[model samples]
Target: MTTEHLDGNALAGPLGEIFAVDVTTCTGRCASCGLTTPVASLHVYGPEPGLVARCPGCDEVVLRLVRAPGAAWLDLRGTVCLRVNLPD
Candidate 1:
């Protein structure tokens, strides 16, 4: 058997579908390690209970997304803040 692992870039499409803007380019500050980087740089894993995004610096879970038939849940507790570029 073989296992396939993907990076944070794989999250771009799914996140784009949920957010009106592109989240891959957004910068997120890791609460655990105080490191800030593009959201696309985070380590991503799983589609089981939900998609988990972790900080590359400290391996802390920065975000979790779960999409249901009619609902979606996004958790960002491990991130201090998310800096997104909004065009005017």
Candidate 2:
């Protein structure tokens, strides 16, 4: 069977709970492939062990988020940098 996945836009709700900004609109560069794209453009999978987002260019994992009781863990080592837009 094929593994089904969703676009990073799915992260909005989960990430919104943690950040004040819309993180899905942020651009993140892949540490593995150096491809830069919006977080909303990445491929996302899973909500069981948490969410895993991968780069569209190389399919390398760019972000991972795990939520537990009263806490959330976010791993972004696969991402070189994230560009978040701020309102002036």
Candidate 3:
């Protein structure tokens, strides 16, 4: 799929201020899957604030969020972008 997503620095971006996830589940599609699943499980281990967690399904990292922000904006590097309101 797209490799534009940051690996480690992602956690340092707006995501570092995120709150948390309600659930973690596998969706089976690498392109369609959300990084939130493995991130919710805390399956990834990283000492650095900028750390990457691998997706359980694709074995490729889907990035990780540390603080779980209240306002999250997603940028596809050079593609489309989105700003989402995170749950409280």
My TM-score estimates for the predictions, one after another, are 0.88, 0.95, 0.33
lDDT of 3 at 68: 30
lDDT of 3 by residue, 1-88 (tens): 3333433333433443443422232221233344333233322445344344555555554444343335444322221222334458
Report the C-alpha displacement of residue 21, candidate 2, in angstroms.
0.1
lDDT digits (tens) for residues 36-69 of candidate 2:
9999999999888899999999988999999999
Worst 10 residues of 3 by lDDT: 21-30
lDDT of 1 by residue, 1-88 (tens): 1134356786887788789888989999999999999998888888777788888888888999888897888999999998989998
- lDDT, candidate 2, at 79: 97
Candidate 2 global CA lDDT score: 0.94
* Clash list (residue pairs), candidate 3: 17-69, 18-67, 18-68, 18-69, 19-68, 19-69
- For candidate 3, the TM-score is 0.33
* Over 4 Å off, model 2: none
Q: What lDDT is obtained when candidate 1 is compared to the true structure?
A: 0.85
